[model samples]
Target: MIEEARIKKNLKQFTFPRLSGTDYEIKAYKKLTKEVENLNLKYKVQFFTFSSFYSRIYPKIGFSSVSIILFLFYLNIHMSISIILILILFTILIISIILTRKPEKIQFITKMDSQNVLVKIKSLSKEKKNYDRIALFISHLDSKGQRFTIKIRIRIFKLWITSSISLTATIISKNSILRGFELIFYIIGLFPLIFNLLSTIMMLLNTTDNSSDGAVDNASGIACNLELLNHYSIPENRLIIIYGFFLLELKNAEQWVLDIFIII
Candidate 1:
């Protein structure tokens, strides 16, 4: 049977601060390690770092730039090509500055009280014999700021719609003059894509919440894994559960894991 008390204990331990690279997250990891030890399960803490670019400011700037470009394109003004080149260059420079600016690091941060935190969990059954591994459980315990306004969202949607239409025109048009217009539309379409890319980047650097309160985002999953651990008692098979709290955006890693799962 699943140990409800143990699960609750894990949940309680996770309730504290869990910001990545912070004392809280480190504390949580230590607590997790303790729990694994109490259960006689082998465990390890894996430390990894990723560039904190996306979760900061790229999305807002990219979205704003795309919106402006789309607006200008819609107006049908025949500006000199030189002006367009200058504007694009200026926009790139602005985005580069916004994205590369680093936040001030906290120097006097308190160290996590590692005595109560759990760092890893492993199954005792696997230590004695070889077994086939099934499903991996994963979760992230981080929150981020989403300051995008409704107006910006609407603008992005419209830019996407317009870009799609422009792409279609570029693909189907054959006449030289129409082809030129299609090229212009195709170029406009790029703005939204670029904006989306930058928005994705912005999400990576903005970790603003406890990595452990990730209960809804992950504690539930941990509960499920614990249940799995209890029910699947086959000594010849194994399962690996990972409670991951990251400081960066998770889309790429999540997708890669999903793809691997599908293949396996």
Candidate 2:
């Protein structure tokens, strides 16, 4: 059974910013390992390196691509130029998607080391070796602080995208009524550019800090995982349960790579 008291205790202990690739995060990992050991639960620690380049470059790419696309529209440039820009944008998007799927392919610049803690439990069935299924309980242990909260950032980005799309639609529409208001649409389109430019600048100036404790995002998750580990550690449990404490979900100083655990 999951105990609220135990969850609260764990949450209290872990309620602080533990940014990835930093000493605090390492310390938190150590403490978590200690807790698992105290529970007499076997666990594995996975250490791996990752680059923050993907995370940092995304905003810049969005800003630049949008800027160029709008500029081409504003100038009513040659179709050849517009096509080339579109092709370039498509290529970049494809490459970025590929890179996101395969972090190992990323170059070593801004590389940082982080770890995950995993606890795997096997079924106690007579045919233990042939356990039917595996279960996973995952949580992230790190937190990040930024100039703007996620909500604010999301809203700003959405506004920018919506304005850009509206402008593009209005400018390119065949309807005579829409075409007559091209200048007004263009002016409205500029609002998103201002937002995009400011966002890009903010991203560039962003620095890692320990302001957010991340209780909800998520010490609560860790606490729940811990309780699950405690409950499933018994030999009588019928299913295989793997509890994983990952480095993080948010990008702090560097990215935290997952799926790199070594069973002990």
Candidate 3:
């Protein structure tokens, strides 16, 4: 039985801020293991490390690239030279993005250790070998905090994207109507550059921390997964269930787990 009281209790137990690589996160992982132990289920812990450099640097790269391309449009240089510069900038951006995705291939940042908890529940049926399917439930175990709220960040990002598109359209379009209105469009484009530049500066200023209670963001999710674990543990259930309490901030960790599952 998945009791609401038990679920709420679990939620309350996990509501505290527990940022990855921190002592509080270790405490939360301990509590999670204890809960699974109470159910008498065997589980495994998989540990891994990741760097935050890519997450922090990618947005700045995108913003700077856009700003520079827009600035190029106003320069009095030869058209061929301007095109060559833009192509070079784009090539650099593409390479940076590819390199950052595989951060281990480059060695410029600090790596932080984290772990994921995995539990496998066997099927009750004697014909389990015939059933090759497994059910997987996943919930992340880390909480993040930043200076700006998610809503504010989303709005700023939307505005930046929309303005960038508009500016690019104005710069490239050759329609007579648009050409007649080019002066107005250029003037309008300046505001977004200024505004988005400030937004980018604000984004750079914001730092990750551990201050939020994380009740809604992930405590509730963890609670629900616990309840599901309780429900699916019954001998009457026929399908195997795998519960994964992952550290999603580290994408490679999740991929490694999936690879293991595939090999199984």
lDDT of 3 by residue, 1-264 (tens): 769999889999999999887888999999999999998889999877766666666667777787678767743268899899899889879988888777744445656778899888888776845346666777888888877898988877787777667666656652344677666766766776666566666667767788877898799988999898888877675367788888754355445345233222
Stretches > 4 Å off in candidate 2:
77-94, 127-130, 174-208, 248-264
* Better lDDT candidate (1, 2): 2
lDDT of 1 by residue, 1-264 (tens): 667886776565566555555666666556555544555555444344433344334454554454455445443367786468549956785755654453222112232211111123344553533123424445554422234544764565565555545534443442244665755655654664455444433433333444335665555544554444444433334343333333343432443344222111
Show where candidate 3 strays beyond 4 Å.
Answer: 75-88, 100-107, 128-130, 173-185, 253-264
The candidate maximizing TM-score is 3
Off by over 4 Å in 1: 74-78, 81-133, 145-212, 226-264
lDDT (tens digit, per residue) of candidate 2 on 1-264 = 778899999998888888777888887888799889988878877777767666566556766676567656655678898889878987887777777776645765588788878777777776745554456677888877776778977776676576566656655652345777766766765665565556555545555566888899888888888877888887765366677788645223122223323221
What is candidate 3's local distance difference test score?
Answer: 0.75
